[model samples]
Target: MDKINLSVTIAVITMFISLFLSFFLVTVKTEHKLSNRLFAFFLILNAIDISVNLGYFFDIPLNARVFISSIFFLQLPAFYLYVLSVCYADFKLKPKHLIHVSTFLIANLILLPRFYTVSLASKISFLKKSSSMLEIQFNHVLVHIQIILYLIAAFMILRKAKKIYLENYAGASMESLNWLFQFTVALSTFYFIALLKNIFKFTEYPDISESLKIGLFLFELIIIFWYLYKALNNPGLFRNIDSRLKLVADIVSEDKNSAQLIDSEKEYNEDLLKLKSYMMEKRPFLNPSLTIQDVSKDLKIPVRDLSVLINHKLEQHFYDFVNTYRIENAMDILRDVTKSKVTVLEILYEVGFNSKSSFNTAFKKHTGNTPTSYRKSL
Candidate 1:
């Protein structure tokens, strides 16, 4: 098949898949309903954008085609908002969020006087000379700006969210946003390909530019199918941390030389003892889904204090601190002759670890041997 036919076929497949996924996300029951709905809206906007390429085949009206092309302005904002929703469970759509779509509204208004309001013959003339039109050039600039700003914003949000999860939650919670991270990486790849296509559009090689466009559609098809796989396999992937939670490093920076931050040696030792006592007696590490806040409440300590104690004073993340205790317990079980009949899998679960791979990793870190090797040596 020729380039146009191949590109059209891929676009059709991608749009249908994106539409199906969007509908599925909207209808699916999930704790992150707002996130799902936002992502579904993003997918719908993507479908609209893809439909822009097929307008010529269908003899679409010029006015309608011009209006639909404005969908480009909305795509990045919708995607950025979806990232925000996924990062924070408490995220809600408010009047303030409408500001994100201001560019899309402005783009339509800019087209109104020159293209939308013109007669049919004038509109045709405008299209034939659109590349030279100041309004069209300005819109192109806005799209490039959106592409850079929104994708960078999404990456920043994901990076911060991942850090918070690692510092405050157990090892099992580390991969909660892994799927979203992969999705963002895929989205970035799509934008990079588009950037290349735009650069090549003005070059001497027309065939190379057209080939890049077709390659983009092929990439889109791959991404949509990947999304389907992740959505089906990891339905509960959107676990979120409280957005208000601040990192221990930020807290320390604010009070770096405060007397309260530099507690008396006695008080420092006392807090350490208290934390160790609670861990031993309560075995909170065995909870599998434990977070620093959960331990703070149980110990009647402030989350900030607990964070400082474990994360800064102890020089370990809350995840690492908890897993250390879990690994110690697993070692004891591995050495115990009475529990020799118990499998390594059973011992890992009994000691509060949910995944065998993580359990084995922690075990190796704590002891220089795997669980089975450690048991056999005993």
Candidate 2:
């Protein structure tokens, strides 16, 4: 097939696959209903929205054109909700959100009567017209404005959320928002393509060729597949992290009465003392993959309090702080070679170091000797 027809084939196949996956996720996946539903809704709307391009390429019948405008209205809202559901489970669609959603409903309802009356040939002729009516051009501008607003709102939320996560958590392996960050970039690029296609319609300029729309849809296909790959492999990645972050958000945000006044420094010092006592007594650092949140929970202290105490006051990330304790334990075990009969690797694992390299590095830094050497010297 030629370049034009190739774009059509790719666009149709990609959109079809996207629509199919959305259906499959909603019906088959029980893990994250809210996230999946929102995602599926978003994709389905895109599938419908791109039908205009498909109509241009193939003579596919679009008997009812006006109702399809509703898909445009729903696209942004659906995507915005998908971000919220994926990023924050506690965030439900409140009545305030309903106000935004009503715009989609109203846009569709207002245009439905006029669109129903128009034939496919008229719609095609309107597209072919070098100078369409002002109303159509304005509507195109309004649609783009709506999309830009929604994209900005979603990106702001995701950016803030990612900032908060980085502040509270230290491990890269457990972080789930990395894909989300990339998703935002892809979505933003897709909007840029859409804007280019729609922007000049309001001007005296002749409408661009079907090639631009074809290229636009082709890029969209790539984005859809990328999204599908990430979503299918890690269906509940976002939901899982959302609930986790929510649990500790209060603790991580204000750090337990950040504004509470009553000898603030003295109170913090006292909490720090209590925290140190708990750490010494319980030795919770012996557990692998221990987090500040875990220690906070064990001490019945706010996660914010523990985070502030460890990260700010003690001047160590939670990872290093835990490993510090682990190294100390390993040194003690190394010195007590008479009772333990433990190997260096055993000491490493027992003290919560995930690997020997990390354990030796920590041990040597603090003790000036490897676990084996330290034991030998003893």
Candidate 3:
């Protein structure tokens, strides 16, 4: 296909998929209602982005194209908020969230008199010399600024959320967050390449700029398809972590100079022994959806202290700590001559793992053998 035809075809496909997913996400019944709606808004914004490009391909009127392009300012904000909502269960759309779009509002106000209120002929002439206009250049620079700032914020939230998930819950939570992590990294990479493409457009090589645009279009199409496949396969993947939960490491660093730190250090060995005894006797890891809060409640220990005990004192994440006991439990089962006929799948569930892949991974990590191999070795 010709370059224009190929770009148009890709844009059309991307726009439709985004719209479809936006509708589905909004209408679908899920526990993560806030996250779903925010994600839906992000998808709709993506669809709008595709529509702007498609308008250029079809030679839409300058006035309409200019108006449509204004929405470009909202895309990064929507995506950043979506990331926040997906990561934090307590996330809400407070009025303060409007601050994120201050740039968009400022951009519109800057254009109100210079472009938006101008006559059609003036608007045409303005765009003709837009390459040299200070306001136009400022807006372009502002877009790159938004991309960098929002991408950094989104990544920070995802990183904190992953650490919180690891230190609290065990089961499919990590898998859900892994999908978001991969998606964030992939989207950030796309933005980086698109940034490079935009920079290349200003160079003396028009042919290279055109090739980069085509490559970006193809990359965007592939990303959208990958998202669709992952979303379908992991429909219940929107697990959330409490935003208020602080990591044990963060807590320690913040309190390093406090008297409480000295006291906590004194109790470290006692707390470690107590935690180990509880794990051995209670076998709480047998619960597939176990969380650190459950243990805290059962042991009458403060959640923060319990987190320090498992994560800081034990020198392992709550996930790895719990999985270690689970693997040990599975080992006992594997060594049982009486249970020799039991399948590896059955044994994994019996020992509290929810998925064969995770069970196998944890097993190998702890035992240096797959469950089947461990069983056969015995």
Which candidate wins on lDDT? 1
Please give, for residues 1-378, the per-residue lDDT of candidate 2 as tens digits. 476677668778877987898888789747568878888888888888767656655655544454565568888788888887776756666777777777666555544444435776776565466246454555666677887888899888777666555445433323356677678778888778767766554455524634566777778778877877866775545642334553234454554467542337887888878877876899887776566677777778877566666666666656666667788877777777484667788777777765556677668888788777778788
Total clashing pairs in model 1: 0
lDDT of 1 by residue, 1-378 (tens): 588998899899999999999999999988888888888998899899999999977988999998898988898899899888878767888999999989999888999898999899999999899878989989988888889999899889988988787789994645657768888889888988898887787778868888999999888889888888877886665678778888788888877756467666797788899999999998999898899889989988888988988898889988889999999998888878888899999999999988777888888988889998898887
By lDDT, is 2 or 3 better? Answer: 3
* Clash counts for all predictions: 0, 1, 0
Error of 2 at 184 (Å): 1.0
TM-score for each predicted model, relative to the true structure: 0.91, 0.69, 0.91
Among all windows of 10 consecutive residues in model 3, the one with the lowest summed lDDT is 257-266
- Which residue pairs clash in candidate 2? 251-304
Q: Root-mean-square deviation of each candidate, in angstroms?
A: 2.4, 6.7, 2.3
Q: Once model 1 is optimally superposed onto the true structure by TM-score, how far is the C-alpha of residue 122 displaced, in angstroms?
A: 2.0
Poorly placed runs, candidate 3 (over 4 Å): 56-61, 253-257, 262-270, 337-341, 372-378
